[model samples]
Target: MSQSLMVAFDVPDKKAALKLAEELGGGQGKTAKVGMELYYKEGAAVVQDLQEQGFAIFLDLKLFDIPNTVQKAMLQLARLGVDFVTVHAMGGKKMLQAAKRGLEQGALESGLPAPKLLAVTELTSISEAILKDEQNCRLNLKEQVEQLALLAKAAGCDGVVCSALEVADLHQVVGDDFFYLVPGIRMANDQVGDQVRVATPAKAKAWGASAIVVGRPINQSTDVKTAYQAYLADWQGSEQEK
Candidate 1:
């Protein structure tokens, strides 16, 4: 599978999201992640609009619910012809399987390829202290993430959404067939923000991330295009000898 640097369109509405997408790619086909902030506000219409402009969509709702409910929701999302979708891996194997089944069925009906189903292992925002104190988990952060990744793979997920810090270890344990899509990407000079486990784009690339999702570093920059190009350069190892 090809690697991608997905631009997260974390804007609040369709107009802003579309405007940014047009500015970035101008219908030349770049992957754009539509997270809950935009999706909840604009619904599927925004996805359609982006696709109409030749941008591939990564619908990152991170669905977590009962098996049947998640399955039904996946069915609907599949029809949107998104390139990827996410679910919380903590939901367990049955729910993941149901989601996969729903996507398959929905895609078949819609005559489009099923979007890649990626399981969210642990948010980059969660620290080990939070995991132990608030979530009451026995395993260390890495252990918990590994277990979730195993469950997701067994349940037929295409890959996982995890921190870049975990990708190297996960590759050793989970093998390379399953892709690792890392988020919480920051450039060296960028503020860490709310993400506790952030990594630079070059680090994510070195650690073997199949894809990287970036938002603020690109979207919040005064020079949006230049910022994206810099991130892409790091991701592709264009700035250094490969």
Candidate 2:
């Protein structure tokens, strides 16, 4: 796998997402994640077209349902040739196992590489205060991330979607081979939006995150391509900073 970022296309519709994907590919990279809204409007056609154009697609639906329902959905998602997909870690061990089993069965039936399944541990919108005050917890932000990550791993998940803050410690905890797809990444001067745990692109890279999931910073930019370049440059600068 290349050390590339997966920019998310959270467009209002699939048409916008397709156009955005083309703009981002202004050849800097060849892949993007298609999230819920776009996928709903365009259906699997969005995934098929991008894959045809050589974009490594992350079908970021963040699937969460019963084990059987999720398994069935995974089987359908498999046929579309997406490079990666997301499931919720809150679903627990048995459900995660069912997802794994579902994916394997799908691969055996389809005869293709299975999409890498990533567990979404918690939403980036959540804060330490929210966790402690709202969720009734005592652990700090980093500790909570670790706990959920461990749960996902013990349940046979391939990777987890974590916020930038804990990726370094998690890389140490979960090992390099276990994937970490981090989001809530805002630039040094960017607005944090609804997200509470964001880091700059450089910080995410130093944390040993396998990939960064950036949205509004790039999507809402006056020039999406320029924003993307800044992110790439920030990531490239991470090594020197370290």
Top lDDT: which candidate number?
1
Off by over 4 Å in 2: 1-3, 26-28, 238-242
Clashing pairs in 1: none
RMSD of each: 2.1, 2.8
Determine which window of 10 residues in candidate 1 has minimal summed lDDT: 233-242
lDDT of 2: 0.81
TM-score each candidate: 0.96, 0.91
Clashes, model 2: 0
Instruction: Tell me the whole-model lDDT of each prediction, alpha carbons only.
Output: 0.91, 0.81
Alpha carbon lDDT at 56, candidate 2:
85
Question: Model 2: clashing residue pairs?
Answer: none
Predicted candidate 1 versus true structure: per-residue lDDT over 1-242, tens digit per residue = 12288899999898898778766755454788999999999999999998888878899999999999999999999999998999999998999999999999999999999999999999999999999999999999999999999999999999999999999999999989998999999988889999999999889989989999999988877777788888888887745322
